[model samples]
Target chain A: MRIAVVGAGPAGVYSAQELVDAGLSVDVFDKVPAPYGLVRYGVAPDHPKTKRIALALGRTLGNPAVRFFGNVAYGLDLDLRDLLACYHAVVFAVGADDDRLLDVAGEHLWGVGSAAQLVSWYNAHPHADDSFAHTVLAAREVAVVGAGNVALDVARMLVGGPHRLAASDVPERVLDLLARSRVTDVRVIARRGPAQAKFTVPELTELGKLDDVDVVVDPADLAGADDEADSRRARANVELLRGWAERPTGRAARRVHLSFRLRPVAVVGETAVAGLRLDRLGVPSTVPAQAVVRAIGYRGAPLPGVPFDEETGTVRNLGGRVVDATGTVLPRLYVAGWIKRGPSGVIGTNKADAAETVRALLADADGFPAPLKVGPATVPALLRGRGVRFVTWPGWLRLDAYEVALGRSGGRPRVSVDDLATMLAVTRAGDL
Target chain B: MTFVVTSRCVGTKETSCMSVCPVDCIHDIGEQVVIDPVECVDCGACVDVCPVDAIVHEGEADDPSVVADAYRRFGLEAP
Candidate 1:
């Protein structure tokens, strides 16, 4: 049996590996020339340890039964109809890339940005513009809107000492910006009380231990706000907050204020962000901030010829089977990961998610009509006919080696190749 | 009894392990954190607090070399 997976990210690759283990040849396609979607793009560069999970994902892609087709966009190059015609089944694992907007006044101002954009800027995503680095360096104070892990990551990156970021996979442009940054205050604002915060315990505690940054928590925010959950994680977050609240103010050069029960009413500025107006207990208060980043969440874009639920920003699916607007299953079509369940969970979470979908696909295998005579070679031939230049697994390895070589002299890990043209060039380089 | 810090702790110096280490065996190297196996009491406090699941028992690391590397990183004998 042959299966095609759209996306080379954790979700798509993990599902492909599961299918390959079940005695099927799997083809994984990605828009970029490299694999490991978010692991390469979404993760904060300072947290290289978290990105290490990519090594395990890399091993899965190395399976002999699996083939990678990079630089091949699904909708632009081949639509859903074309996929159904060639393979017995197609699994869509394209993750949510767009950031959820704040929708408040002055949101489109010059200094306003998204946490995802900052993450991309640091990680050197090909799509992230180079100008963002200049904007980041110019800011004196930043306001991060949200209470989740992404918000904490943004806060940490803003106040992260130069020493913490200098050794990671951060690109040269971002490193230059970090060197010139004037940022002194970073406020992480949450709409709800401390107990309702979405940040994980480890991420929150790590903030307190920043060598040169002071973690300040308002004691009043903790009053009457009891942790609503029974889990150890909930208690951990509260305990961490209380610990930060008790930390005596120090002479730290930078400060990260973990403020809660404050909702952004408006981004107050005419042409660029100068401050923010927030509503706390129905009282309006203005806080000075040069930059505003919304870490609210991510929303998925609908794939061509696929049913999508606008409310959830997810492809319509049930037990990994894609369903149409009429609630009928779209035969031979399936989805997993953020596009299937909305943006949530860490990288390892995708393993079980992919496994669940693979089981459903196997259960319905008999119903899928015999795949067309077109085999593994057929797809590549078709792509070649269309004048598309795709990167194979070996091609990706060449680019990986190039990145590592680039960072070797600096005593850092691989320095990411940010531009698409350079990435394609490196992937095509001979003698890997 | 011994404890080891794997590659997962390289960039993420999640110090929950250090806070829980009963014998103060966990040491922060510049690039990564390490545990002194000789000083370690094997209290299992570090294992429960590692956010990345990077800590493991002496014999339980997915890569045996990672444990030795951790010891070498801290200039200690592999337990």
Candidate 2:
């Protein structure tokens, strides 16, 4: 049985590994040269321990029955019809890559960027450029909009400073840029009170350990005596935030200001970001800040030939079966992870999502159409014909080696290949 | 316009506004209730579940736009 998993993120890699363990040939494709999508690029570099997932995912890539087709874009390189013709099943584990735009005026101005772009630039996502990141580093203060783990990660990165980032896999360009940043104040503003914050306990706890970072929370911002599950969780998080806030100020430490009940009205700056205009709830008042990074959440793109609900930003499906735009089931197609469900939950949530998709695939395995007979040699020519610049397994291996060598010079584990030319050149030079 | 609750209130069993609504946008806020705006989409599922008879429809009482605006201010998109 042959399956094509479109994406090399946790969902795709895990699903492919599960299918291979169940005795099937799986081809994993990713647009980026590297595997382990968000884990490598979206995650903050200071959290090297959280990045061990990449090493575990590397084992899945090494599977003999599994093939990694890197730098192969889905809609651009090979369309949905092409995958349907070739594989027994096609699973879309593509994540929600698009950032939710802040609808307020002045959001498009300079110094305003999504948490996705910031995380990508620092972690060296190939598509994230240096110019955008430099604009953010130039700011003296930043206000992160939203209360999720990503917001915490961004705030922590801004406050963690150069020493904390040096040993990690952050790009040298990003490090040098951050080293010069005078970012002293990081205010994490949330529209809701503490109880409504989406950050888990462990993530909230990690902020307390940062040496030069002070956590701040106004007592008035705390939720009232509500004992509901959400409120209780918020209370705990607030208690943690308050505990750190009460501590003596650290010498030369940056501040992580946790503000609540504040909705961003607009980003306030003419050329570059100067501040954000925010509406405070209850009393109905407004506030302003120097810079704003909206981290409300991520939303998935409408996949070509897939049933996507625009409101929910998810492909309409039932138990992992792919449905059409009109809700009709598509044969041999499945979906898992964030694309299937709107962006929510953590890494472990993908396991259940993938398991359901796998069950559907296995249940209908006998009905799979015969795959097109294309070997290793035919793939390159076919991709070239389609104008697809797919990085072969060997190409990815070369890029991996090049990154390791680059990292070695800086006394780190790996550096990232941030563009197509450098990655291709490394492969062509037989660097692997 | 005063916002009215529609038919999609299938899963919501508890209404917390009966005691809390200052203008009594809800007639009783306690019992089977209705938003009494002249434009009310009088699908009062909230009426059956309201712990108090505090919900009021448009013609049923005075204007509730001020109270409705409070809900909107909290970032809850008005019904």
Candidate 3:
């Protein structure tokens, strides 16, 4: 069977691997010129180990039974009807791309931003805005509004010291801009208490290990917090926080202040972010921060034809099967990863999640009529007809080599090309 | 003795170790995955499966600091 998987990240690529193992021909499509959606973009550049997963994912795309169609957006390039007509089954593994808005005052201010944007900027996502570097450098004191891993990542990047990131895959321009940043004080704010924080223990602990940076936690925030009913992970987080609360504040130039039980009400500023107004202990409290970065969570983008849940920010589904508003299953339509489950869990979580979706699709395969056998030339013809300049797997390999070569000259791992024009040029050059 | 997931597993939470664990000792703790010593059978199934080669025998860890960090992260006592 010929199957089409949307979003060539961990979900889509892993799903393709599973299907290829099951003897199905798979075509993975992504809007970006490269693969590994969050791994290459959302994941912090310092985490080279996590980025290595891209190598495994790249190998999967290299499989003869699997093909990659990069720089081709599903809805924009080829609508749902076009995909349905071309393949027997389609799985939407498109992850949550946008950040959840705080829906408060002054969110649109010049200095206020989202962790997703910052992650994109540092990781060199092709579509990231240039203003991200300017915003990051302009703020001396920044307030990161959230408690998840993403929040910790932003906090760490702000204070991780440029020398520490010099060895990573961070682009040369980003490195230069960050080296000039005046940011010193980073406040990671969470609405919940210590026991209810979303940050894992390892991430929280890493904040304390940063060079010339002090992790400051309030002793009162850890007082009387009952972790009795919490999971082992939650209990461990509280333990880590308690340790941070007791540590003496040293003479570090930078500080990562972890604040809990504080609800951010608004990003208060006249022109740019001058401060963050938060509700601390049921009272009005204003934290002096030049920038506000909301890292609450990520929201999934709605597909053109797929049924989406605005309330939950997920594609309506039952065990990977896409269901309409009234709970009607749309045959041959499925979803996996962040879009199906509402953007939680780590990258490994996508493996089992995609497996489940593919399982359901395999089970339902016998019920439908045998799909018409179409050659590989059909989809490429359609893309070419629509003037969609798509990148093949070999093209991606060439672009990857170009990026690595760029970084190699600088003694870094890789220097990401973060613009479509440059990426297209690089990929096209690979076709030579 | 139990296996430990070092700094290499921080961002790459590959569960090849978890799937191979007979006792199901590997636990996802958000930032990284850890193997529970009490539950681990010392099968060494994870060492080979680690894509980044993050898994190592507790005694053979190249970096003592990374091993200690793993133990502290999982709330486990060092060997």
Q: Please write out the lDDT profile of model 3 over residues B1-79, one tens digit for every residue.
A: 6678887888888777775443346888887888776555554556646788788878778888766776776676576
Summing lDDT over every window of 10 consecutive residues in candidate 1 chain A, give the lowest-scoring window: A224-233
Judged by TM-score, which candidate is best? 3
Model 2: DockQ vs. true structure: 0.01
For candidate 3, please provide the TM-score of chain A on its own: 0.96
What is candidate 3's CA lDDT for residue A339? 96
Tens digit per residue, CA lDDT, model 1, A1-432: 888999988899889888988999888999888899998888777767556656757887889998888889999888887788888899999999888988899898888888888888878888887565567568888999999988988788778866788789877767777778898899999998888887876578778888889998899888866546455566768888888888797689999998988989899888988899999989999889888989889989989999999989999999899999889999999998999999986665677788889999999999999866577778888788787778889999988999999999788878998889998887872212
Error of 2 at B62 (Å): 61
**Runs off by more than 4 Å, candidate 3:** A226-229, A370-373, A429-432, B1-79
Pick the DockQ winner: 3
lDDT of 2 by residue, B1-79 (tens): 3434432332442445332221234543332334444322222323333443343333333445644643454445444
Q: Which rank order by lDDT, best down to worst?
A: 3, 1, 2
Q: What is the TM-score of each candidate against the true structure?
A: 0.85, 0.79, 0.86
Higher DockQ: candidate 1 or 3? 3
lDDT of 2 by residue, A1-432 (tens): 788999998889878877998999888989877788887877678766556656667778878888888878888888887787667789999999888988998898887778888888888887886675666667678889988989998888877877887778777777788889878888888887777788766578778778767787776665471443344445667678667656666564588888887888877678767778878753444334455788999999988888888888988888889887777888888998899987976664676678889988899898876877545444456677766666666777777888889999989987776766787676662222
